[model samples]
Target chain A: MANKADTIISTLITRSRKPLLDEWLARQATMAGSGAIAADGDVKEYCTRFLAELDTGLAAGEVGDIRGAGWSGMRELLEEVSRSRAGKGFTPSETASFVFSLKAPLFALVQREAGDNAARLADELQSATTLLDTLGLYTVEVFQKAREEVIARQQEEMLELSTPVVRLWEGIVAVPLIGTLDSNRTQVVMENLLQEIVSAGAQIAIIDITGVPTVDTLVAQHLLKTVSAARLMGADCIISGIRPQIAQTIVHLGVDLSVTSKASMSGALELALKRIGKAVVERKARPAAEVS
Target chain B: MDQIPILMVGDCLLVSIQVDMHDQLALALQDSLMTKIVETGARGVMLDISSLQFVDSFIGRLLNNIASMARVLDAATVVVGMQPAVAITLVELGLTLSGIRTALNVDKGLALIRRIIDGEEQAFDRREG
Candidate 1:
């Protein structure tokens, strides 16, 4: 409480700026060499800029908390590093090493500054280690959160890309589900299928689940719900692409799929056409083909 | 105090519900539709509920009652033009409305009713059994 801004870190950084940059860059060059970020990155520029901002933050005498008013610039710098590194596919360690690598050069400076005074040496080293550890851990937390946001965005895009309701015929529609069917996805699928049925006036719908990897009881229940909703809107639903395995699973689960189901999409289509009083017949064979 | 107009097209009575349906409106519709079916000797009823964006369990039961009363009056009721959202809501509420016939639109609804009336297509059987 009596001392303010009389810190060893400000003195240590102000004097040993060049040595700190050189050692930090050297350590960074060997960090998981040549996997994600390139060796000739602008790490030099960041080292210099971070040193300058950090020197100011330390001089302001609020080293106990990096989130304090004194360290706004340093915090912003770490956030920038996190965002850019996350976009470039940097792993958690690689991103966090940007801060952690500074510790070695800093401790060495503390070792030199404290000289023969053993008590001062321990005190400065303790403060330095605590500050660097806090900052390094903060970097890792930011990087991890950034990566999670990226994953969440990709998941949303995949959901949008996956569900597409196709009009197979004048009065028929098909939805080919291709991934794991969760409750969220089932809601999207059911809404899309029912909307298509109404807009296209599709009397029959063929739900081709050939690409769906598994059909557990929950998925089967979702399917039944969609069928019931479609029927309420006066559109018949025909589930096709019931591979032998899925069929076995459905029967084993004792899920009574009372609606009409066919083994393949074409079979479903054929039934839908027949229900609508239409049939696809082969054209008359060409005379040349007949001769062959 | 608004009444849903029931337009009689030939032998089919077309009730296109273009307004919001409350409990009072539903009961009024049942009363008026029952009276009209008895008077006109209509063989079929088509309910166009495309404009209905909301419904509760009571309205669901009202639809079932309307269909049952029409069948007793010797008329087959085919509900048509039900919005997709309304259909999903009804299904989510666990009401299948299995007692009534359903079609895509007015043209198809009329065709289904005619087929049932002429003994071509079997009307959906709703009974205690």
Candidate 2:
């Protein structure tokens, strides 16, 4: 009786073998490809073949009914494959390699569809490409753009300082400012002026603001710093050029300019000469103080 | 008095900026002038404010900021052309700029700068020659 019970159990387990084997094979394929199988039309064909094999096996008492499930069974198999692959880990190098390898395929796709839509595609791909680079999955061209941006910013910064200075006369130095003045550039201007005044041993420095478009609080602060620095070097600095609009704005901002010695470019020139104990003798002019 | 024109004479940046006594053109001038200074890399700055009927705190502060910035950038800043009335106004306004260097006018500013730079160059020449 014990032998007969054992035999019955063995027979029941045997009957399930074919179905189990079929399920196992489907799982293996899914594990190998991840969800990549769904991207291919060939996967459907493969599934059909698998089902046919399953059916033949079951009919022959070797897993026959499994194949009869057809498309539904195949779809289920794909879903399982996708899920299995989703959990896999990729090393950094592997991920990088994968992204790099995609360059050829991406380029191919672009070339094929690039006839009328290249520009749009390029723009769309730009951000994605940058994102990938930032993630360390960089393509060569994307890396190049990042490099270019860094270089440009460096160049702009370099321009702010180390601008060459030229001396006009004894005890007087003039700095002609050009272009726009932002907060950062203003800081640069302050530093350069102070250093030059000290190093060149200037006694009077002229700052011409004729090219300046406008002045704000920050800019005003910059001008003040220059004056203080010059004074520190025992130099008298002149600030010139007062545009009509700018003067009105200064009053509006409620800032004062009491300690700064300013003049028109002409007056500043005269002051420079006077400071050096020299006075210009005009042919038919009034007193030195009555020019205006 | 009219708006001053900032011009580059040799190493001396001649700035004849017309600071409107009652306007905000000074701020505008700062913006444009800074852009040029950064671009052209002028050695020194000269400001002529004869056009200004009054000098206020705002202009004074900007002048100071420009000076400090110029020093950091290895440039010199100078203010030229101050009208007597404007100077008095600036004093009354209690606006005191710390680092801004001033001269009388463009010529004076230029001459001072030229002399200083020449002395340095002569020293450099003595060293290098």
- Most accurate candidate by lDDT: 1
Tens digits of per-residue lDDT for model 1, A226-267 = 898888788899999988888899999999899899988999
Residue B124 CA displacement from its true place in model 1, Å: 15
Instruction: Tell me the fnat of candidate 1.
Output: 0.86
Residue A41 of model 1 has an lDDT of 72
For every candidate, C-alpha RMSD to the true structure in Å:
5.7, 24.4
- Model 1: residues >4 Å from true position, as ranges? A1-6, A10-77, A108-117, A149-166, A175-192, A209-214, A241-252, A282-292, B1-59, B69-90, B104-129
Deviation (Å) of A104 in candidate 2: 6.1
Q: Please identify model 2 stretches exceeding 4 Å from their true place.
A: A1-136, A139-154, A161-164, A260-263, A280-292, B1-129
C-alpha positional error of residue A173 in candidate 1 after TM-score superposition, expressed in Å: 2.2
